[model samples]
Target: MSFNNGGYLETDDALRMLDLLSQASGSDFYMSLESKGKKVAGEIQTLFSDNMEVLEIGGYSYVAEVASAPGSGKGVARGLPLAVVRDCDAATASIASLLYSQDSDLIVNILVFKAGGDNADRQPFFEIELTGGRVSQHAILTGGMPKRPCEIIVFSYRAVEIKSAPQLVSGIRGAVRSAKLVNN
Candidate 1:
């Protein structure tokens, strides 16, 4: 699902997501789009594109437009696409979650998104992936735990809240595992 608004990668309502993902270093931000509609879950695979010099954001993939030709997608225009995971594997998501959920004071942008393709009757499950927006290093929380597509929330990290961060992430992992087990 793509929006028509040009240039603005983030909507006004994206403050929560921005703080949660872009400025995620110390805050728990909840995402609630202003209007009626379903929010699209971003996948890591789409964030980090392959070494093709081409960039992919959302469902759109673009590269540098020729200098002589008309304006297609360049500098800021490219960045207009929301920052999200461009590419990822199983371990990627695990490591991302751990990294984002880590106990720290310095804030960083950590994008944890799921692949929006789970069917209702097929045991709802989501695949978490790391979207390296502004953050550099990342870790894994529930490396071996399973994730439920329907039960995932994006939040920010706070200074004092860093204490129970590990346990909190563990709980999320446990819950994901439990859901997987129940589904099976």
Candidate 2:
């Protein structure tokens, strides 16, 4: 698909993309968007099906701006910052792998978000000491939060010329955090 920088996808197209990712990876897909004191699931499917506006980031990531209002439905809302749905798995892994293969200064941040409490209450939970590139042995836990844990990993490489490593990491982190789940 010819994805514009900020183009929005219809629900059917989004669902199709999710289906393709699931088939390719052999796993079901889910977007975590909290609402009404709980994580909303099928609402994402419903919103997409209804052609709600979703922001496309870097072709692989998408963010749906959900309204915080209770009865507010249909098209995208104007002012309120409602909820966010992100494709927090396969696409992230692909990005990390691609960055890892390219350069040595590449730093990959794996952000694990568990269910239960709000995003704010969940602060810098813990960090793992990695001596090498592989993270296969680590079991990331978040103080027994929700059963449905979602991970959003971002990769950044230090610039050889102008930008510093911290700058690059910060920019990448901001971008990744802003991105909501659409498809893998």
Candidate 3:
């Protein structure tokens, strides 16, 4: 659908469009995209290029512009554990705050990826990656009332372009979440 006459998307319309896109492409596609903390510019042009309806949407240009901007996907280090939280809610809030913060780092997004190898027996290990935060130093993940140090493990990094989105979702997520921690 096209934007309103003002050339802007309303919240409801935007949400609806996202719902349609997610439904059409499947949650697994979005989950994979979200997991890797990557933007959908590539997919829009490649995966959905054949769909005339999707191509007609005017918002794709903005997505591509944002993705190609300097320091767009370059600033935030992937898979850097900032701190430990009491629960998942706290973690979500922390990530949101960082994304909304006005720091020079301009954090665009935050993502969590599995750090454990293909071992179901291992605990559900994961790490955080910041998309556009200017982290100058490495920080440890500490939390709780008394506060204790959490062990840091080797994380995965996406060294090459993933050719198959469906086949390499898990591998991509794992790799995208493997960057060393950095702090401002």
Candidate 4:
């Protein structure tokens, strides 16, 4: 159940662990982190224009970019949409590409911060859980997440959904297809 001499789980090992955990089929959930700060908005736009593989999760779309320096706790991010897409429940949708750190180890969590209310640390709109350790913890849910935009000012995110994994890849694929327009 290890990849290298470090004994860290590799693809094969990870799968084996999942098989044992009975959570093989992961969930495809996401966090919509919202922000109106000029600095945050500008950064998201710049990052999106730079990336080629735009990760379209459901009605949401995002691109991952790296933070300029180390220990910044900041990184590439997403911006609010100019218009609403069908099936996109929330009005203000922003995904945050955050650089996380645990025990001096760096990690990343791309979340979707929704809009509404006035609290900044309110509950989430969705929960995205990953069996593999990416965004801390095993399950993330939206039970306690508040329905406000200001509640998500910063602090990146942490999924609360109780699922194996958020199937965002497939969801992104669907989003891309839905984005396709007809030449009238």
> CA lDDT of each candidate?
0.24, 0.26, 0.26, 0.25
- Using TM-score, rank the candidates from best to worst: 3, 2, 4, 1
- 3 or 4, greater by TM-score: 3
How many clashing residue pairs appear in each of the predictions shown?
Answer: 20, 7, 7, 31
Preferred candidate (TM-score higher): 2 or 4? 2
TM-score quality measure for candidate 3: 0.25
Which of candidates 1 and 2 is the stronger one according to TM-score?
2
My TM-score estimates for the predictions, one after another, are 0.16, 0.20, 0.25, 0.18
Q: Over 4 Å off in model 2, which ranges?
A: 1-93, 96-100, 110-115, 129-184
> Tens digits of per-residue lDDT for model 1 on 1-184?
1233662323333222222222222322111111112222333222121111111122111122223336655422112122232223333454355446553232222222233331221211222121222222321222112221111222222211111112132113112431110000
Weakest lDDT window of 10 consecutive positions for candidate 3? 55-64
Alpha-carbon RMSD to native, per candidate: 19.9, 21.0, 17.6, 20.0
What's the true lDDT of residue 95 in model 1?
32
lDDT of candidate 3 over 1-184, digit per residue (tens): 3346784444444333332221122122111112233221222322221221111111111110112347576544323322211112223333333334433332222212233233222211232233343322112243432233321111123221212112243333222223344233
Give candidate 3's error at residue 44 in angstroms: 27
Question: What pairs collide in candidate 3?
Answer: 76-131, 79-129, 135-183, 136-183, 136-184, 155-178, 156-178
Better of 3 and 4 by lDDT: 3
Better of 2 and 4 by lDDT: 2
